[model samples]
Target: MTTLFFDLDGTVSNNFQGISRCLNFALEQLGLRQLTDLEVLPFVGPPFRESLPRAFPGIDTEAALKLYRERYATSGWLENSLYDGMAHAISTLHSQGFAIALCTSKPRVFAERIIEHFDLAPYFKGVHGPELDGKFDRKTELLAHLVEHYKVAPENALMIGDRDKDVEAALHVGAHSLGVLWGFGSRKELLEAGAKHIVDRPDELVHTIASIA
Candidate 1:
């Protein structure tokens, strides 16, 4: 059976609106000017501090990190909702014998909530997410830990995500990568990062994976 690790935010959830709202809210509270959607959208995949600096240039990294977490935990994170057709795709993959799991940058506590909220618990064998600290900050490190934890060989595993981070993560661990265009990222970005394949929609995902194998 093929093992698949999926990123949570853009890939499984259509919660970008909530994320944007919360980010701006945090900025507002910090007395900083609010960011436009396009500006905030880039924050969706990268670390909060990295995004915040771009949004609030020359801002203190420590304070920015603190406020980012505070806002997300208090409001932004909970506003998330799973994307349409995700449940069906997950169910179909499970029934078809794929080993699916979540490999995300979001913290584990909220990751668990998102999974349970969507009633997607059964579809995933495990959930691995990067810590808020720098320890597991990169996708490469997170993917490596998940691979070791699950005891799945790199060749038998695939990482599915919406951004270059996901593709980069898979490649770092010698796993295949599947990038999705339906999410926040563009095909140009994924292709540039050397994604093995790309899926335009949820239903097409299964076929894409099979063809890759």
Candidate 2:
């Protein structure tokens, strides 16, 4: 493929600790019951707007979002760490001449900060994500915008992510997808979402991308 779109949360870095902690912080602020990290795992890959409402069932998502970001911006963002071999995989691909960028459901500013925190800023061409105001919240919309803005053919791009939404977004825009088992998603979940290729570890990422692309 000429271009590669990588998902942030689960694929590139293991941000579960940060995400779950922030989620609980928001819940505690709302005087709601806090969830364990494992309980919060399902919400990691999806937008917080969707997850908050579903978790609380009739709470103000906007308020929860504000609280989540309040904590995320300060300490939660720094809680993340790169997946084993992810740096190697990304650098290897960049050296091979594939254009790489981040495609995440996170707000652009937050995603940018996380990239910089991980010292991964130089390897990426751009960060594609929604605004804090919730524009382009859907994966399909974001992917479509990235494709048009970058002048990339859908078929010539491969989206690599750890969740089904990533595969769905790629399919919606007619691009290829590779699902990673190292993240939160299970094998059946990715296959059911129509991901054609799957890799079990970060070390296998480069070869898997080469095969799919």
Candidate 3:
């Protein structure tokens, strides 16, 4: 069977509002200036440590992550909704016996909670993510771990996500990469990162995956 690895933020879940709010909350608490919604887009895919320092110079990554988590656990996590048609697409793929798994850079704890909250837990065979301490924060590391633990062959696997990192990670693991346009990353960025396929909508994703599988 073909294995499908999905990214949580931007791809399956539209948690932009919650993520932006929590990030600004962290910055505010740290006595730093807040970022606009557009300005916060780049923070969606990568680990907090990498994104935080770039957004706020001289900030303490650990403290910022702690504050973001504290606020996210309480309210920010709930401030999210599934992207349109994403549920249906996932259900259809699962019904068709695809080995679906979540491969996100977000902390595993948060990824699990978010998936459960959106009732998406049943659709996935596995939910893999980084540790709370930020170990395996890179997409390549996370993807490598998932592929090994599940014994999935790279040629039989596909990675679907919204960021360049996702595309690069798939390339690193010798898997196919599909970039989604409805997410944070731009089409140009996805192309630059060497995405093999690009889909504009959830229905398109279903079609693309069907064609490949």
Q: Summarize candidate 3's per-residue lDDT along 66-175 as a digit string, tens digits.
A: 99999998999888889999999999999988999999998888889999988989999888899987788999998988899889999899999999999999999999
lDDT, candidate 1, 81-133, per-residue tens: 77777788888888889999998877766687779878899889987776666
* TM-scores for every candidate against the unseen true structure: 0.92, 0.98, 0.97
Residue lDDT tens for model 2, 1-213: 899999998899988888889989998999999898678988988887887777789998999999999999999989899998999999999999999999999889989998988888899999878999999898889999999989999999999999999999999999999999988999999999998899999989888788877
In model 3, where do residues sit more than 4 Å from their true spots?
none
- In Å, residue 19's CA in model 3 sits off its true spot by 0.6
**Model 1 poorest 10 in a row by lDDT:** 128-137
lDDT, each prediction? 0.82, 0.91, 0.91
Query: Which regions of candidate 1 deviate over 4 angstroms?
Result: none
